[model samples]
Target: MTSHNTFHKVVVLGGGYAGTLAANRLRTRDDVAVTLVNPRPEFVERIRLHQFAARTGDATINYRTLLGKGIELVVDSATRIDANTRTVRLASGRALEYDYVIYAVGSTGEPPASVPGAVEHAVSIAEFESARRLRARLDALPLDAPVTVVGGGLTGIETAAELVERGRAVTLVCGRALAPTFSASGRRYIATWLSRHGVSVLRPAAVSEVRQDAVVLADGGVRPSALTVWTAGFGVPDLAAASGLRTDALGRLLTDETLTSVDDDRIVAAGDAAAPSGQPLRMSGYAAGPLGARAADTVVSRIAGTEPAVIDLAFTGACVSLGRRAGIRQLARKDDTAVNLYIGGRMGAAIKEVTCRFVVAKRIRREADKPGSMSWPKGGPRPAGTVSPAETASSAGEVASP
Candidate 1:
């Protein structure tokens, strides 16, 4: 490692999970100067957005309390990146130079633009402002009004469950099967649990159009609702594309195994904005945090004249809340393969709560400790030629049998 005075400057953009962890890790290092740039002064606990929509008031985190001593937190969005000069242009008309940069801008929910009147009428619970808007709408709606939650993904399911617990009439509309990514057993567990909680599930039905008071289905059926929530999909911000970096069709930066931008190594992408080299994982906090931590370690290793290590996908699971006291825990292998392990009821809820608390505590610890000063474990790029299970599976599929 370089001497404290000789270490270079590092700038981390986006103070979400990935950016916050990156800044915290780098601040621990006495040699490197760290700066965190984000549009909001506070960190939004994005995973708890559903709770906020249910009027739980759980989406805010104080950056001042989370940032370490040497790390500078800049409340502004990064608008431009000059890879050639290693400079980042902020939306606030400030330019910062850095030896390394970590991009963790996260993502935004896709507005209900496809369905007419949905964008103007439906509520989204993705961002802090959106959740607040939804909460206000819920408070003003009639007690017996029907609410339709579009999409059956994790976000949609969680939102629907939370609303149901609030004594609201909820209808979950899924175009296909619910929790399609889960194992067969997990899918059954979730469907049964949701059905038992007074949530009506509509499957194999596509929303032809969304009106102010009802949604028209493909089969010429209409579902009445006073409040509609659209959680169908998410769209990453166009910052990378706007800054002239390479991005995939969905606007996610194409990243290699090391989480480095395919177009520019000086700029690394993480969190929801990064697409894995071969096997692209779903955009979730479970994956984003590790990717962010790995990206930070990669930048540090490069500066320390050591080769960057490849990421090891060890912990991959899905924990969904059915309500305040019930949840479903679906386990998965390192290769992103789902297993038939389901945890539900009160015990599952406790597990889910603990998991969320662990994430928060982990961030707190990282911020308190900082980066380079701590002695991190050492391992090679590929773990002595033994590829990760995900990599091995992909390689085997690519080989031609004799």
Candidate 2:
């Protein structure tokens, strides 16, 4: 039998906020060998994807800078996880064994399959490569091009505002009131900021179909657009479900409050891919990093023959970036209920910018330097009635499209 002090191997799938943090925090254990698997060589900061799509920022972080010295970086995609064999099969024909696995592939643009013609016509700013494609497409378009942004979430808001700030004729189609998750005051600030940036807002307007050059509204109204960017919602990878792991409807790996897999004790989940207590955790980097750390702690505790504690995640608020120069900060309670408090205009924009920077760079770097240095807001237990944005999109795999 392997002794408790025997060297243990851990493989982290996905190099996003959660996966990276999980791997970094695992460095503290000298007996654990950590290997991170990712498709790209550079870490794409999904949070700043809109800034990159707008040509206002660079979001690529080289693995050399973000990954710690003890973690080995493998450039590949995981196609299958064989829990029976305790191995992961890669697209590159490599098989990796692990004492524990962290599934944190995060999310990507909602597949264009949600709407007719969307796959063929609409563009997006959901990931690094997708944002690059959008940037290039925008660069080729004329300055006066009419652009339509779908969805009222933060991504939609930031994308429309960024384009409008660049002098593009922008319109946002919100199926409901803008920023539905935000407080009324927060929503007002965002609406006003977009208006000031010359972005036309369409509310209570539903899009029935996306065309080659426009979107068809549910009311049978057709709006012409030179380019349509779909920011509707996001969908996570289906690896967990495919691997026969217990997952929520959206394929998010199901875990107990301790972040341990319900089916396999050797497996855990974090970030956008984790569904703890049958509830999908918050999608933001703020929640993802801490969840990853918690997963690491759980696995470490198990290896050390100790009882692991349950997850304690709290949401402080949501920061909506209107553009490079404007934003809205919505304060919230522990359960993610928006309060009546908000900050807007340039001040909000600055705060949002700093927060993004810290999430993408500063915080992870600090944690890499000093393992376990990171901390997250842990309010009361997650309220039963409150559903996170991720859970709202959860379905029999028909999740929201980004």
Candidate 3:
């Protein structure tokens, strides 16, 4: 077993925004050896995954350009983690023991099996491989083939617009309000843009089932859809729960405000895979960087024999690109509730593009060049009646505070 007093061995799972940033930030201590384990050799710009599937852009970057010096990158999937032994078992049957592990495995777009045919017929734009498959399917489709995007969220909206820009007939089937997270004005603006762009918009229309050639609506109406893209929600990996670490309902590792796992201080959680105080932040690249940095800070503070600070990362706004020419930048309060203020059209599109590039080349790579350089807005106050992990564990007699 690795000893933190002499040298800290930190293992970061996943190479997404959170994992990559956490691994980079671990460079704050020269005595800390950082190893980033990922299934892919490169980093996926998750924010641009929609554009990637639409062939508007590529979403991968070489880890050489993103990882800091001396941080080892392991190209393997972790099958399970043994929390008792502080070891991660990989699919290749290799074991990696660590003094600390950062759970940043990120989220996936796998459609729920509850929706008949969705798991088998619908494609997802959430992950790199799924997006690649969606792209190949799109490439082989007729230009006028009708494509249906099922979801009112940013991913579905962006994907529908991108497909339309590629000269494909597209339909956005929002189970509820279009751009539900956006303010009323912002949704109106996006709706207008889509209407002008020749994309059909359907709201309050849920997909009961996704078939190969059509989608059966909740109203029992059938819409011809050559391709169906599901982006309703995301799910995190079961790594935490499988390892006997506590997780919230969505399988995100439950952590304290400092991102330390409830089960062990040696384990930290970040990004979409972390449920801090039973409340996970918005699953976007915007939140991933700050969460990743904070998780790294927790591990570093432990090695330095200091109390880690609580998370104070705030959300400023959300940007959604409508094709490459238009977008909506919806401003929000620190708590992430949408406000009336917003910017739309080409200006919004420009800002969204810059934000995407900044997240990768500037925000992440800058941290790689200089550890602990990443910063975010101070977060709002925690909600009332929020329970800390230690408190919850104590009440259940599962774990005692250190």
Candidate 4:
């Protein structure tokens, strides 16, 4: 056991928005040593992944410019966390001992296996490597090739627009409606924008099977698709459950209001991988930064022998980019329900671009340069009532921001 005078060794899992900021924020305590573990050598701007896939923008930045001095970067994947032993087992067989562990593995797009041929034929835009493979595939196909985007969420809309701008013939096969998370007005705006931009918008349609070169709808109609992009559902890594820790239905670490794990106070959670109070905020970069900082604060408080603060972050809004020159920003209540107000067209596009850049360049990088300097809006109304862990696990899937 570490003595009171010994420095606290903190190991942060996943170098996404939450994990990166949490690692930097831990620097606020001189007695803490921060080590960030990630599977990649670079920080991926997940928000700009659609642009990256379309070759419209770059999405990766070398970690040298994003991580703070004295912070160790472990280029390895965490296979499991042995909480009882206070050790993290890596895929490479190396084990890391830590005084406290921060779980922030982020989220991913997982196509449902029930749909035949989806896993083999369709590509996902939820991650860096996946986007890279998508780009390569798009490069190999002719611009006029028929491309189908499945899912009507923000990610699907953004991907469809990006591909259209690259001169590809695009069809958006939305399961229910376009921009389902946005306000009614926002959805109307997206539908009109996409329709006017030469995109064939198919709504309230379900894909029964994803074939090699076509998608068979539930009604038995087939749509020709040279390439299929799946952005339907988002899911977290099973690391928490795999490690014998309690997790929500989505596999997010179960945490208290303070972001401390319900199963172990020595372990905290942040980002998309954390389900605080069993009612997690929508998995978005807008929420991830604040959650990261808060998770670090809990760790710092424990080391200082003080009471840790609970989560109080608020959701201001959600934004979706349409191609490179147009977009829409949907305002929302503190509780995340969309309001009537919104900004569309070129101005919306500019703000969307700025918000994406600020997340990494300013919010994350600044925290790395100046620890504990990041902050977010608070005073949002706390969600009332609670659901059983089993109930939460069976709830509907949550999609991260595009």
Candidate 5:
């Protein structure tokens, strides 16, 4: 057995949005040693992965410049966590002992198990390699070949829109409704916009199976397709399950509102892998970034023997692109509920672009600044926004197409 020194080591598992931000935030403290463990050396801009699949944008970030100075980067996949020993075992047989651990291993694509042939024929955009494969398939297929997209959530909607802009014959398969999380007006706006672009929307129906060249629906109907994309759901890493931490059925680490694991306060979770108390919020970069920063604060407060500060959420806006020049900009409350003021068309697309850029910029800036010493910008009036109603009545009249 190897004896390890119990240093002030802070080990962050998974270098995606949450882990990256937490590591950067904690790096400012000279007393703490920061180590980031990830399967890859570079950071993946997950929100723009759809653009990458559409062959419109790159999805790689350089860790040398993006990681905080003095933070050790461990290029390894975490396979198990031994909370009792405060050690993480890696795929490479190495073990890392930590005083504090941030479990930020994000979610993976839910395997296409329910739909026969989907696992064998359909491709997902959950990781970089999968996106690359989808792009290659798209490039080789005839330009007009039909492409069917499964799921109507943000990712599914974004993927369908991007493919439509590529001039592909696309059919979106939504089991229930489009953008179910959005307001009724927002959903109708999205549906009308999709229709205007000549993309078919199949709602109240789901794909039961996917073949190499066709998708079978639950109602004994079929749609011919050259390619199928799955974005239905997400599953968290199993490391927590192996480590004996309390987790939900989907493998998400169960945490209090403070985002600390109920089993062990020394281990905290954030981002996609975390299920906060009460209803689960939509998994987005916006939520993950703040949660990461707050997790860092929680860790710092624990070390200082002070109360953890309550995280202050601010509503900026949410932009969903229909194509390059058209989209919807839904302004939201701090909790991410849609508000009344929304903009669509070129302006909305521009705003969406800016929002994506802002997420990247925020990460870059936080990595550049010293951790623990960092604080929010001073003296700005609180932004105005409100939570979206649980149910919104729709005003069903077609608006002018963008």
Candidate 6:
């Protein structure tokens, strides 16, 4: 949109949903040079990580296909960012200067060493490499091997359900109630589905430590587990914080309502790593696409010397796949409160499958074909004094609430 003849260099760190969206959409401008930096050459479908761990499908989309022409894709990691010099230092000993920077690095899983004795016994499918390792482990295990999944969040639920469907003996460990934010009816439905699949749900039970062949519970009870999959919570990379950018408690980059850094207008943020208005957003699908687009639009507006609108996101529903053939879609209020509306059983499964097929590139294609094709939840614009995403847990692996 800018009339300037000079090309603007834009460096996008991380190639997650938000990073991909920003890189692709920014290509709509002929005057901008978009360079996407990611550690892997392939695009990771983080949504299907559980399925990947269950040997359902590979969790990759060729980055070559996802990114359009004119966008440079760098296969490397950003080791540091020097805001004073406006440059990004990569792990490969290379550096790139940029007119604008997009911080879209998403959430990640911790290694076993992160938790007590977990490294020696547990596994996590938080990234493509880790997911591949999990799939390999699943392939090598016996059919009746007992696998315990820690965390009652969406990732834990999906991983537990998927493994159970594959005929593995599965148990879900939760520090609190399963799907605690969901409405009573929604929780009941989840419980019913999990029970029907023969998955053991251990609620009010916390895994104090993960052992090689057993899990030590908070109550001093030990449960035998041939395999342990950790899906508890996700944490963001410390790149922003390490680079001297202001970050929240969870290390998410702090931004203003327009999705730009409160300290530097040259920097913008979106996706899970963005904390706007002193509040952080949920690290789930609920915020990914919407925040990604808003961040891109803000960068574009800035280039064109126009003001970008404050990010206004809404909530509609979430789709969670129980297995290959069963799923649940939970609708919610604009503020993301669970409602009684839901579609369960085979129909919900079909809906979930359709949603999974939605890749980040499709969004770029839409933007190139349609100028204002942003999809908002519940028609967007929250009501006065409504709670924002900071108040709720946005697990990428969950969908239904009502």
Index of the highest-TM-score prediction: 4
What would the per-residue lDDT of candidate 1 be over residues 240-329, giving only the tens digit for each residue?
Answer: 888887666677776667777767767777788876563345677776667777888888887778877666555456788888888878
Greater-lDDT candidate between 2 and 5:
2
Candidate 5 lDDT by residue in tens digits, 1-402: 222343368899988877888888885556778899999988998878888999888898898867878789999999888888889999999999988888899878844676789889999988888888999999999989999999888788889999898888999999878987677788888999889887899998888889999999999998898999998877777888888876766667766656677678788777778765523345677667777777887787777788775445554546788778888887765545667667888888898888777766756455556555433322222223211211111111100000
Q: Write the per-residue lDDT of candidate 6 for residues 227-339, one digit (tens) a residue.
A: 89888777789998889877777778777777888667889998888877656556776577778788888889999999887788777767778888888888877777779
On the 0 to 100 scale, the lDDT of residue 316 in model 6 is 70
lDDT of each: 0.77, 0.82, 0.86, 0.89, 0.76, 0.79
TM-score of each: 0.89, 0.93, 0.95, 0.95, 0.88, 0.91
Per-residue lDDT tens digits for candidate 3, residues 1-402, read 446577789999999999999999999888999999999998998888888898889899999999999899999999888888989999999999999999999988788799999999999988999999999999999999999999888888888999998899999998778888788998899899899999999888999999999999999999999999998888888888888888877788888888898878899988888887776777888888889999999999999999898888667779999899888789988877789999888999999988988888877899999999988899566544435666644221010000
Minimum summed lDDT over a 10-residue window in model 6 is located at 393-402
Better-scoring candidate (TM-score), 1 or 6: 6
lDDT of 4 at 87: 97
**Mind giving the per-residue lDDT tens digits that candidate 4 earns over 294-385?**
99999999999998988898788899999999999999888778898899999999999999989988888998889999988898765444
**Candidate 6 clashes between residue pairs 3 or more apart in a chain or in different chains:** 112-119, 318-399, 330-400, 339-402
Compared with the true structure, what per-residue lDDT tens digits does model 2 show for residues 1-402? 345468799999999888998898887777888999999999988878888888888889888888777799999999999999999999999999888998888887753686788888888777877788889989989999889999988889888988898899999999888888888878888888788778999999978888877889999999998888988877788998889876777678877677777778889788888877676665677788888898888878988999887788877788878778777778888877789998888998898888878885666887788877888788756535423334533333222111
In model 4, how large is the Cα lDDT of residue 375? 81
Lowest lDDT sum, 10 consecutive residues, model 5, at 393-402
| C-alpha RMSD between model 1 and the true structure | 5.5
**Candidate that beats the other on TM-score, 2 or 6, i.e. the better one:** 2
Provide C-alpha RMSD values for all models, in order.
Answer: 5.5, 3.9, 4.4, 2.5, 7.1, 4.0
Clashes (candidate 2): 4
Instruction: Give the poorly placed runs of model 6, Cα more than 4 Å off.
Output: 1-5, 111-114, 359-362, 368-372, 378-402
lDDT of 3: 0.86
The segments of candidate 4 whose C-alpha lies over 4 angstroms from its true place after superposition are 1-5, 383-397
Better by TM-score, candidate 2 or 1: 2
Give the better candidate number (2 or 4) by TM-score: 4
Q: Which portions of model 3 miss their true places by more than 4 Å?
A: 1-5, 383-402
